[model samples]
Target: MFNSIGIPGLIIILVIILILFGPSKLPKLGRSIGESMKNFKDSTKDIMDDDEINQDEKATKENK
Candidate 1:
Protein backbone atom coordinates (compact mmCIF):
# COMPACT_ATOMS: atom_id res chain seq x y z
CA MET A 1 0.00 0.00 0.00
CA PHE A 2 2.77 2.39 0.88
CA ASN A 3 4.48 1.63 -2.40
CA SER A 4 1.51 3.07 -4.24
CA ILE A 5 2.29 6.51 -2.83
CA GLY A 6 4.28 8.05 -5.64
CA ILE A 7 5.74 11.52 -6.13
CA PRO A 8 2.34 13.22 -6.10
CA GLY A 9 1.40 11.54 -2.86
CA LEU A 10 4.66 12.58 -1.23
CA ILE A 11 4.18 16.17 -2.34
CA ILE A 12 0.69 16.22 -0.90
CA ILE A 13 1.93 14.78 2.37
CA LEU A 14 4.68 17.42 2.59
CA VAL A 15 2.17 20.16 1.93
CA ILE A 16 -0.07 18.90 4.68
CA ILE A 17 2.82 18.68 7.12
CA LEU A 18 3.87 22.20 6.21
CA ILE A 19 0.39 23.48 6.92
CA LEU A 20 0.19 21.58 10.19
CA PHE A 21 3.61 22.46 11.51
CA GLY A 22 4.01 25.91 9.96
CA PRO A 23 7.12 27.17 8.15
CA SER A 24 8.93 27.99 11.40
CA LYS A 25 9.13 24.36 12.52
CA LEU A 26 10.19 22.81 9.21
CA PRO A 27 13.87 23.60 9.69
CA LYS A 28 13.97 22.00 13.10
CA LEU A 29 12.08 18.98 11.87
CA GLY A 30 14.40 18.60 8.89
CA ARG A 31 17.47 18.90 11.09
CA SER A 32 16.19 16.25 13.45
CA ILE A 33 15.45 13.95 10.54
CA GLY A 34 18.90 14.57 9.08
CA GLU A 35 20.59 13.72 12.36
CA SER A 36 18.55 10.58 12.75
CA MET A 37 19.41 9.46 9.24
CA LYS A 38 23.09 10.11 9.83
CA ASN A 39 23.09 8.04 12.98
CA PHE A 40 21.29 5.20 11.23
CA LYS A 41 23.77 5.23 8.37
CA ASP A 42 26.73 5.25 10.73
CA SER A 43 25.39 2.31 12.70
CA THR A 44 24.65 0.36 9.55
CA LYS A 45 28.19 0.95 8.32
CA ASP A 46 29.61 -0.26 11.62
CA ILE A 47 27.53 -3.43 11.45
CA MET A 48 28.67 -4.12 7.92
CA ASP A 49 32.29 -3.59 8.86
CA ASP A 50 31.98 -5.96 11.80
CA ASP A 51 30.45 -8.63 9.58
CA GLU A 52 33.32 -8.29 7.12
CA ILE A 53 35.87 -8.58 9.91
CA ASN A 54 34.20 -11.70 11.25
CA GLN A 55 34.09 -13.28 7.82
CA ASP A 56 37.77 -12.51 7.27
CA GLU A 57 38.71 -14.11 10.58
CA LYS A 58 36.68 -17.19 9.80
CA ALA A 59 38.38 -17.59 6.45
CA THR A 60 41.85 -17.13 7.97
CA LYS A 61 41.23 -19.69 10.72
CA GLU A 62 39.85 -22.19 8.23
CA ASN A 63 42.91 -21.81 6.03
CA LYS A 64 45.32 -22.28 8.96
Candidate 2:
Protein backbone atom coordinates (compact mmCIF):
# COMPACT_ATOMS: atom_id res chain seq x y z
CA MET A 1 0.00 0.00 0.00
CA PHE A 2 2.76 2.43 0.97
CA ASN A 3 4.94 1.43 -1.95
CA SER A 4 3.31 4.03 -4.16
CA ILE A 5 3.70 6.81 -1.58
CA GLY A 6 7.50 7.00 -2.07
CA ILE A 7 9.80 9.53 -0.40
CA PRO A 8 7.95 12.73 -1.20
CA GLY A 9 4.65 11.39 0.03
CA LEU A 10 6.27 10.13 3.21
CA ILE A 11 7.88 13.54 3.76
CA ILE A 12 4.56 15.27 3.24
CA ILE A 13 2.88 12.98 5.71
CA LEU A 14 5.59 13.62 8.29
CA VAL A 15 5.28 17.36 7.80
CA ILE A 16 1.54 17.19 8.33
CA ILE A 17 2.00 15.17 11.51
CA LEU A 18 4.59 17.64 12.76
CA ILE A 19 2.29 20.56 12.05
CA LEU A 20 -0.59 18.91 13.86
CA PHE A 21 1.29 17.57 16.86
CA GLY A 22 4.20 20.05 16.96
CA PRO A 23 7.83 19.25 17.77
CA SER A 24 7.30 19.16 21.52
CA LYS A 25 4.86 16.24 21.45
CA LEU A 26 6.73 14.25 18.80
CA PRO A 27 9.16 12.69 21.24
CA LYS A 28 6.38 11.52 23.54
CA LEU A 29 4.38 10.25 20.61
CA GLY A 30 7.41 8.36 19.30
CA ARG A 31 8.09 6.86 22.71
CA SER A 32 4.50 5.70 23.08
CA ILE A 33 4.54 4.15 19.64
CA GLY A 34 7.79 2.36 20.43
CA GLU A 35 6.46 1.02 23.70
CA SER A 36 3.24 -0.17 22.10
CA MET A 37 5.24 -1.98 19.41
CA LYS A 38 7.42 -3.60 22.05
CA ASN A 39 4.39 -4.82 23.96
CA PHE A 40 2.84 -6.24 20.80
CA LYS A 41 6.07 -8.06 19.96
CA ASP A 42 6.33 -9.52 23.42
CA SER A 43 2.75 -10.75 23.36
CA THR A 44 3.21 -12.34 19.94
CA LYS A 45 6.35 -14.07 21.12
CA ASP A 46 4.56 -15.49 24.11
CA ILE A 47 1.73 -16.75 21.92
CA MET A 48 4.20 -18.40 19.52
CA ASP A 49 6.00 -20.07 22.41
CA ASP A 50 2.74 -21.44 23.74
CA ASP A 51 1.84 -22.82 20.31
CA GLU A 52 5.22 -24.51 19.99
CA ILE A 53 4.84 -26.10 23.40
CA ASN A 54 1.37 -27.37 22.56
CA GLN A 55 2.59 -28.87 19.28
CA ASP A 56 5.45 -30.59 21.04
CA GLU A 57 3.10 -32.10 23.57
CA LYS A 58 0.79 -33.36 20.85
CA ALA A 59 3.70 -34.94 18.98
CA THR A 60 4.91 -36.66 22.11
CA LYS A 61 1.45 -38.03 22.84
CA GLU A 62 1.15 -39.38 19.30
CA ASN A 63 4.49 -41.15 19.59
CA LYS A 64 3.39 -42.81 22.85
Give the local distance difference test score of model 1.
0.98
User: What TM-score does model 2 achieve against the real structure?
Assistant: 0.90
Off by over 4 Å in 1: 1-8
lDDT by residue (6-27, candidate 1, tens digit) is 8899999999999999999999
**Model 2, which residues run further than 4 Å from truth?**
none
Please provide the root mean square deviation of candidate 1 (C-alpha atoms, Å). Answer: 2.4
1-64 per-residue lDDT for model 2 (tens digits): 9999999999999999999999999999999999999999999999999999999999999999
Give the CA lDDT, 0 to 100, for residue 3 in model 2.
98
At residue 18, candidate 1 shows an lDDT of 100
Evaluate residue 59 in candidate 1 and report its C-alpha lDDT on the 0 to 100 scale.
100
